[model samples]
Target: MFEGHDPYLVALSVVIAILGGYTGFGLAARIRGTPGVSHRVLLAGAAGFLAVGIWTMHFIGMLAAPIPADTVYLVLPTIISFLICALVVGISLFFVSIGEPSLRRVISSAILLGVGIASMHYVGMHGLSGNFTMEHDDSMVLLSVLVAIVAAYGGLRAFLARQDGIRLIASSIAFGVAVSGMHYTAMFGGHFVPLSGEGHHHGVSGLAASQQILSIVVAVLCFVIAAGFLLSLVPEPRRRGARDSAGETGALAPETDAAAVDVVSPQRDHAGPAAPRIVSAPLGGLGQPQRPAPVARLPLEGADGTHFIDTANVRSVRADAHYTRVHDGTRERMCPWSISEAEAQLDPSLFVRVHRSHIVAIPHVSFVRKEGDGAVIELDGPSPHRVPVSRAKIAELKARLGLARPHA
Candidate 1:
């Protein structure tokens, strides 16, 4: 069976797999910390590209095989195989994406995706119809599944890492090689026997046969994957603007990029400025030392619509990627604020930055306990939320909590 294989097609199949893996995993990595429509869109796009890549690579590898000349592909099973790959791949990605990812979640997701890859391959193999009986070496089949799972775990781990261009490309190449290896491994384990009669081949109606069709299908899918990969390479527009390190709750104007603030000043009141004129300097220098009111309510996006949670109700704000998540006694919501923004804008008297990623409302602290070099703060909330305090900030946090022991 190996003798008739086209080495060039096999190489091309592997290339396709690598490209797909690169595009898919790269897209999935971006889903972290992003929320709402953007998050959902990225997940879907990642899954789609990954699935297409896997499916395309499998069929192309099949085309490279030394198979019976009269073989025809079944429509239903082929479609089913693709769908199975897509559904399982999507589920696996989502599994690792939600909440805080742990070792168990990553492994479980990898196992699932690996099994799915094996299933798709075998099912696609089963779709083959010709004047032959197929038999597989059970051990080789199992080995292929094992390879799939291990490779999947590696791909997911690479994604979990803080990806730079070099790592992303390297991981993609590794995954592509593993995926292609699984395909050929499974193929080599199976042998087909030609029957004395071609009756079975003739009866195989409602199916398509010919190397031409396979080539066309692979080409079209490759085109789609290439388009998606190129699109993913394009950078997304920056959603937020830069602000001073000092916490300021600045809102953008209705139709412009200029931040607008309502100011009441006596000197400027010779004719109170109505329209938001661009302040050349900080607002404090305009003879109005009174700063804008502290951020009283945190804006959050929920399934229904945008909602505001009173700062008084917020127990903690934890940084998630570029955004922050607010724990408000009852539940957690994603906020548009960065950790620095949250620390700066929140009232200093009520909220304090306990760690680079954490902002805790002092009034909500229920307990404090030391853990190794750092300490843990248990906030009073509907759900038990623990915020880690950096060793450097322990003293300040304790002072604000009134647990600081007086100097000797």
Candidate 2:
């Protein structure tokens, strides 16, 4: 019934609708984690949207005036009303959900809802024939507070449930029930009189009326949808089972055993002798005839005739015409050979550029530290040294160390 109803009544209805809509919408949007919008930003926008939705609902419903004898049509419109209400409210709640719990968000939502309600009521009242001003009685205050509390609780529940799915559903249900209670309580707060004449003037049906029943259903659906969306927002924590097991083993193992394992890898490589080759006899002869004389093993050399230093072993590269000095950690350890000759003898990959002044073994890198002007590279040898990082070489150093994501 739209036309000829008191504007005050329409305003009251709008206010209630707005409050419900704001809270619902805020919770829904927040749990969804809409990017770039912070909690504060959501709250601000929801306040405006809820107010407008509420005002629009009241004004439009008033325009529809009284429906003559077509109660069935009311159901369709009322459903539409509820749908609109749910969407507006859901978005408002969503906004409130992502932000920090604050009086600001709560008060903002409440005030907007209240303003919508008040504005609608007054506007509708202006259209009424009676000379009356809507003065908020004790009932109005109680109703407003009730709406505020329920909406606030709903917003809170949505946020809590977002972290756990089960919790999210539970919170949604709780919020829906709370909202239903608030709606019924507010509807009953209205003051109206009915005519005794047959099929004459009458007031709203009892709380159990079909219209109210439908409202409850709509409210429940709103809660459910909001809860589901919120649950989707939280990310599941990752599992580190393998790493954890490895850590446990390392922690429990003796230090000497760990060291023994470390020493085994290097020794296996250099200590093993080359496999001996069997020579066949003239006639499948003599059970795999005696092996031939071993050929002289040429020295392993790097590109610049540089030899790898396994300091643990006392074997040193010969000081020959090709290379003049033995380079170690302390001195430049002069060598007559060029870089290319040294690289030819050594594994090029193992020895990499650390800085302009040094070429270090990859296995020797312990860590890379960022210093003010340059990076300080630490080596893992028995004796460690900090090498300076030239600005020109920082990018290369970082790439080699895998300290950062690849820039190119």
Per-residue lDDT of model 1, residues 1-408, tens digit only: 556789998998898898899899998876764667888888898889889999999999999998987787887788899999999989998887776567899999999999999999999998888788788999999999999998889888877754457879999999999999889999989999777664545356566556677678889998988887788788765433332221123211121222232332222211112112212235454543233457778877543445788899999998655567888875466776666556545777788777766889999999999999989999896566778887767877788888885233
| Tens-digit per-residue lDDT, 308-389, candidate 2 | 3443221112222223232343322333332222322334335443332344555566777778867767655334454555
Cα RMSD to native, each candidate?
A: 10.1, 23.8
Runs in model 2 lying further than 4 Å from the true structure: 1-80, 83-91, 94-102, 110-141, 160-162, 165-170, 190-192, 199-408
Report how far residue 360 has shifted in candidate 2, in Å.
Answer: 37
**Candidate 1 regions with alpha-carbon error over 4 angstroms:** 197-202, 238-335, 338-408
Best by TM-score: 1
Q: Whole-model lDDT for model 1 versus the true structure?
A: 0.77
By summed lDDT, the worst window of 10 consecutive residues in model 2 runs over 263-272
Give the whole-model CA lDDT for all candidates, comma-separated.
0.77, 0.40
What is the lDDT, from 0 to 100, of the residue 63 in candidate 2?
36
- Would you list the clashing residue pairs of candidate 1? 247-344
